[model samples]
Target: MLENIRENSQGLVAKIILGFIILTFAVAGIGSYTNSVDTSVAEVNGEKISQAEFEKAYQTQRARMAQQFGEMFETLSNDANYMAQMRDSVVENLVNQLLVDQASRDMAIRISDERIKQTIREMPAFQVEGQFDNNRYLARINQEGFYQSSDFRDYLRVEMTRRQLTQALVSSEFALPYQTSLLTTLQNQKRDIRFATISAKQFEQGVEVTEAEINDYYLANPGRFENQEKVKVNYIALDVNDLAKDIEVNDSDLESYYQQNIVNYRQPEQRRIAHILIEFGDDKATAKTKIADIQTRLNNGEDFGELANALSDDTFSGENGGDLEWFEAGINGEAFDQAVTALTDVNAVTDIVESESGFHLIKLTEFKAEQVKTLADVKEEIAIAVSTQKAQDKFFELQQQAAQLSFEFPDSLEDAANAVGVEVKTSAWLSRFGNAAPFDNAKVIDAAFSDLVLNERLNSDIIEVSDSLVLVVRLNEYQAANTKPLEQVSEQIKTILVQQKSAEKAQLLADELLATHKAGDDISAQLTANNASFEEKAAVARYGSDLDASIVREAFKLPHPVADAVVATTVKLNNGDIALIEVTAVSQGDEQAPASFEQQYSQQLAQAAYQSYVEALREQAEISKRENITSTSQL
Candidate 1:
């Protein structure tokens, strides 16, 4: 529904509110959401990071990754290495956030209440038809599964403070005009060069690999040919989706669900209004007198919108003829909300009302009554919800039974399968890196190879594979790691040895040609004598897609020529050919940079400096990790 709300709205309200709402569902990033707990998972500058916070963040990250990777997401989530890294990253971010929070307070960074209100009013989300609407603001904030206005304000305040401090640190970062121009010249510089290729394949006919060499190579790198460790498991599993298929929902159940969760289908009343405010800041009598004149003008049949546009003190609302669009009660303030709601007729002007901002003369323009959906209108949705609930209940019950039975009968999975009314299934040969269905889960793989399951022949604990699935695995067979014999890999080693010797010969030829070119020898005549292919490139810049990126990058590395100098160097191409390059001429690029280039260079330098500043802060701060709580066991 919130997603639907965002899709239907085209204002800043959707952007701001949806960004926050989506963040709640996002599980990919590090760091914890604000939470309260007594037992500490870590401590930053004497501040305890609670266990609840760590668990929540860890699970959220796991779930987010699972969703992102689809089938492979579970494999990554269950990986011990991945889990460890994610946990450490989350803790590090939390510590950094705490450091920033402390710094913000120590520096006396403050955001006033009025400023907060103004910021909220200025947001495009709260505006309708180019002006701030209090009702729209209230509607967005009132949506469930998002932060309350107070909490959101606090978040915004902290974010603003952090941004202010960051900008202050990097605000002075700049690149000089001369520096940018110099770099631009180098980036666009082109070179005229001729390259002669010496192919390794030409030398391959002369290269030979001996039987003894192949034997030696195979013996030296035996581990390279070793077979991976593999396991087979027999498991009893319960999946929630399977249970959901059997779930039954009656019409009465649907009716009961609709009655209980009816608010989800409720549409609140919305009001559109135009108003004239005369601010009484430090001078009430003057403001009252001004409002009286406006009231008289309204009584004389003058257009209310035109008058409000010209006279209202609220600049944002005044720009749109004091139009505040589509809002429910409690959005602005109690006094203002009551005044707007009490109006019964369109174009009716209210008596002078007082609020924190000032005195207001409210005029109603449009209204929409509250609406509630009939039970029949939402019957299918209710039925689906009721069925899901029942399915979840059955799944939990089966999971509990399976867990208990698996523990009681640790030697075999047959008893657990019988108890849970599930079949014991056998898996194909599973390896550590394999990502097959069911057995792809890291937890299942670890449990299958665990000492208890392998050596003691005990049933593993019930491992939760995903939100919908659980597995109790018993190892059926195991293959010990072993290296393949030298005979099996001798032919493979021979091919590699032959290629290496050929490449060495080609490089030697390229080097000889390079020395001749540097010594002022006629390499073009030498290349013609040897029947080598010589090709000339008129101009080549620092970047291009048509030529080899590696060769192009190497061309720029050559120093500028002095007095008709011929600089030579050799590069190994991807096809095992040696490219011996000799620069005959060079053209330096323009030194004056365009405006866009200058801006880009300046921004790059600023970003680099900001990263350095952040790193320095982390290095200077005192950081500590809890001994009992590592990423591996946090959850």
Candidate 2:
């Protein structure tokens, strides 16, 4: 079960820990916590949520975010709104869990130990070859840090019991047939429309931005005219490839390494054997009697090959006169191997021996003694491998020393570089998105900008660029973010202003065309006179991946029109053009399920109902926090 939990429930383990922590919240009142605990963070009913538990959950969440966001973790961690939302979510999760526990007690929900054991046994992680293995279950549980099986089972019991209650609350809720049909209809609805675009570029000849407009726009949007902050850095790196070139291996060292790892080059002893078996299954006595009769034939000097071919119950080997070709130990069963090895005389049959396979008679045909390669034969290969291993070891050792030296003398990388025997390399100016060799690592960039490294100008903590490399950097020069001068950005701002004016003119003309077209005027002719053509799209749906998506979206939003009536709508396209669309016909989709829509709708309805059920429980529960506990304030 523990193996299964580790394999499939890595994420669920954190959730289970959260559930356990929440279950610790008060059983009765705050007074009980006041007398019984000083380290509790919150109290619900009379149970306590410990400070340690809250810190664990909070730290786990932070670490998870750090892994997911990398350098972005620093920005998100400093966000006040994000932190507050995270804290509230954690607190509400605890509250909801406590309420569920309370509900479970009120409803007297229970799970039996036998059921839990069966569940554990059935878990894939605990099974070997699809059957439960007790040793694997025990080893996995201990490896996962669950020392006591009872506690692990109890933890699972809570989850199982809660799931049962959750299913009971939500499983009955399902979408009605009419509701399902309506959803399917809307999802597959199609509209026939005609659309024409008024390109923004068409107005470019007439639209112009003056110097005053450019100045006004630049002043209004100062953020768009800012220069990026840049920094140059000095760094020392330890890479295995660089170290490997300097590594040298002597013949003595190669021979020593090979001698110590000789087992890897030695082949195991092997034996070739022929055997016959009568398997004991439903009728053990009958199988034993049959094997005894076969052994009597061996004693009577009957040909073993003929006897095996006619009488041996082992099918595959029986056809070939029971010839089990060369195999090493661990291949055949222990009992069979022991019996076969005991027969020292060549081609001599052994007495009937009982094994897991029932009864067997065996003869050894050929044997191969274990052999090892000579030092001369593998010396060159060993030397190269030995050199590589030594180099990798030296790289890691030097990296560690460099990391320590940088911290002990944070002002410069000189001492650290000399200690690691590498030169301090300087980089060109780097921005947040710079991709120069080692600076391509986000960790290196983030550390270079860190407060201690950037502002205080100290050596960075060792940044692991890859498995084979580690880097330590210090800022050499800093360029604070500043705004570009008005003169320098004037032309860029002018182009933006001109484009904005052009798009506005296009939208205005398109709107005028739409108004005139809706009032029975020939807008297509008017657009043709204005150097634009009306394009027709047939049977476009609300959710299609095509060029007419924008027009189709706007057309569907308009109310359905009567026979001979056209519905006019205008939509803005991504290319900064305005599309004037006219819907001529509307069609409802057939009332039929699309694949597994029924099952999907049922699941969504059940989940929504379950969410509501949980919310209702939370609303009714009495919850409190320990005033003295502040360490877990974020949680």
Best by lDDT: 2
Tens digits of lDDT, candidate 1, 1-635: 99986677768877798788778667433234444334666676677777667776777777787788776776676677877777887777677666777777888988887787788878999887987765566466655223234555767798788877777766777888779878988877889877888778767786788898988888788888898888888888899999998888888888888888989989867677888888775688898999999999999999888888898876556767877765456545689889988987877889888765578899888877889999989888888888889888888998988999889988888888998789998888988867587776778888888998888888888899988999998888988789887788777787788888888988998898888878887777767755586788878777763677767767778876678577778899888778887676788788887779877877888889877876776787766776545543433
Computed on alpha carbons, the lDDT of every model, listed in order, comes to: 0.78, 0.79
TM-score of each predicted structure versus truth: 0.58, 0.68
> How high a TM-score does candidate 1 get?
0.58
Q: Please give, for residues 185-296, the per-residue lDDT of candidate 2 as tens digits.
A: 9888887888888888877886777888988888899999888888889999899999999888898898899999898788767667777778776788998899888888
Off by over 4 Å in 2: 1-48, 78-81, 143-145, 234-236, 245-251, 254-385, 396-429, 433-437, 440-443, 450-467, 472-478, 625-635
Worst 10 residues of 1 by lDDT: 28-37
In angstroms, the error of model 1 at 216 is 5.6
Measured on C-alpha atoms, candidate 2 has an lDDT of 0.79
In candidate 1, position 166 carries an lDDT of 72
Worst 10 residues of 2 by lDDT: 626-635
